[model samples]
Every structure is written in structure tokens, then in C-alpha cells.
Target: MPGIAVRTAAVLLVTVGDGTSFPTAAHLASYAGLAPTTKSSGTSIHGEHAPRGGNRQLKRAMFLSAFAALHDPASHTYYDHCRTRGKTHTQALLRLARQRINVLFAMLRDGTFYEPRTPRLT
Candidate 1:
């Protein structure tokens, strides 16, 4: 929601179409091609990789939103955390997009608005 503007929101609404098509956020992420897929065969299992399928428009919207969200402190922190965890720049952005999809799903499901989390002082 941080980076989602009029055009982005329009694209998302047009692409997702009522949100009933996806049962869960995971389903939405998969549809948008943000969910990583695991490739395996016998004992020689391949690692998770970005899938080459799904709605390209939705994927592009999510990806661009994630990139634009980097300006938000929370989003920037998450991106940095992903980078520290050894995720590539693109991978981190994809992960962020997936994370945002979960939030979007919850918002759509509950008809709620975005509320930024406040950092707890410890």
C-alpha cells in the first residue's frame, strides 16, 4: 500500500478482478509469479527458483510497487534484511512483493485499510 498509487491500484484491480479468484494470498502470489517454485528430482533436489509463468501484468505491477516502496522505512528495512540474508537485489524485491501480496490479500479479504506498523522500543 505504501507505494501503490492510482495507476498501480487500477492495474491491480483490473488484473485481480474481484479477488475471489484466489483463495489465499499464496494463491495470489503464485498467480502474480512472485512465489518461488522448488525444483527437485530424487535426492538431487534443485533449490527454489522464480517461476516463468503467471499474469505478467500483475507480476509487473507487484514488482514495480515493491521497488517503489523502497522509500518507506519499513519496506527499506525489510529489503535490507533480505539483502543481509544473502538474497540478491532482485530476489529481495521479489520477496518484498510476495510479502506485500499477503498484506494486500488480508486487506481485500477484510475490507480494511493499510496501517503502518510502529516500531517497538525495547
Candidate 2:
């Protein structure tokens, strides 16, 4: 949630009036167009691709927020982790946005605000 400015938050809130309507984070991600698209045929399945449609405003907001979140240490670590797994910069950012959507869904479900936590050092 780090880099979620007032305007971005407003866009999200407006686009997703009530997050509780989504049963799970995946559902929310799908609705926001953050989930990857899949194509399937009879007995064969194709690889996942970028989603074609959903709430464009929310998707843009999430994308921008994820980009800004790169400045946060925790988010930066996650981005690096994605890159280590062979993801491109854009792919990693999208993945990060999806991850943040999960957290946002949880917050909406629990009616809570963003709470930064310290990562325990091993």
C-alpha cells in the first residue's frame, strides 16, 4: 500500500465500490483486470496472457501504485524476487500489483487500513 496516493485510492474505491462483493482476492483481481487471461480448448490449454478487459480505471491505478511502490524496501524486494524468477520489469510490476490487490482485499474484508510491518531479520 505504500505509494497509493489519495487519487489512486479514490480511483480504486470508486471502481470497486465494495470489495466484499468479491469472494476472494482472485475474484477481485479478475474484476480489476489484474488476473492473467487463460485460453483453453477441448483437451488442450494455452499459456496465460494479459487480461483483455475489466475495470480499466482500477487497473491503471493499481499499475501506477505498484510502480511507485518500487521505492518501498519491501515492495522492492518482492520486485527483485519476481525478476530472479525470470520475469520482465512489466511482468514483475503487474505481479506486484496483483499481490497488493490481495492485501487490499483482506483490508476491505476486515475494514482495516494499511499497516506497515517490519520484516523480521533472520
State every prediction's TM-score relative to the real structure.
0.90, 0.90
Q: Which residue runs does candidate 1 get wrong by more than 4 Å?
A: 41-44, 118-122
Tens-place lDDT per residue, model 1, 60-113, is 999999999999988888898889999899999998899899889988888899
Off by over 4 Å in 2: 118-122
Writing each residue's lDDT as its tens digit, candidate 2 over 1-122 gives 79899999899888887686899999999998999988999989998998989888889899999999989998888888889999999999999899899889989999888887643322
Q: What is the C-alpha RMSD of each candidate to the true structure, in Å?
A: 2.6, 2.4
Per-residue error (Å), model 2, residue 91: 0.2
The superposed Cα distance between candidate 1 and the true structure at residue 18, in angstroms, equals 2.4
Q: Output the worst ten-in-a-row residue range by lDDT, candidate 2.
A: 113-122
Q: How many residue-pair clashes does candidate 1 contain?
A: 0
**TM-score of model number 2:** 0.90
lDDT for position 3 in model 1: 93
- Residue pairs that clash (backbone atoms under 3 angstroms), model 2: none
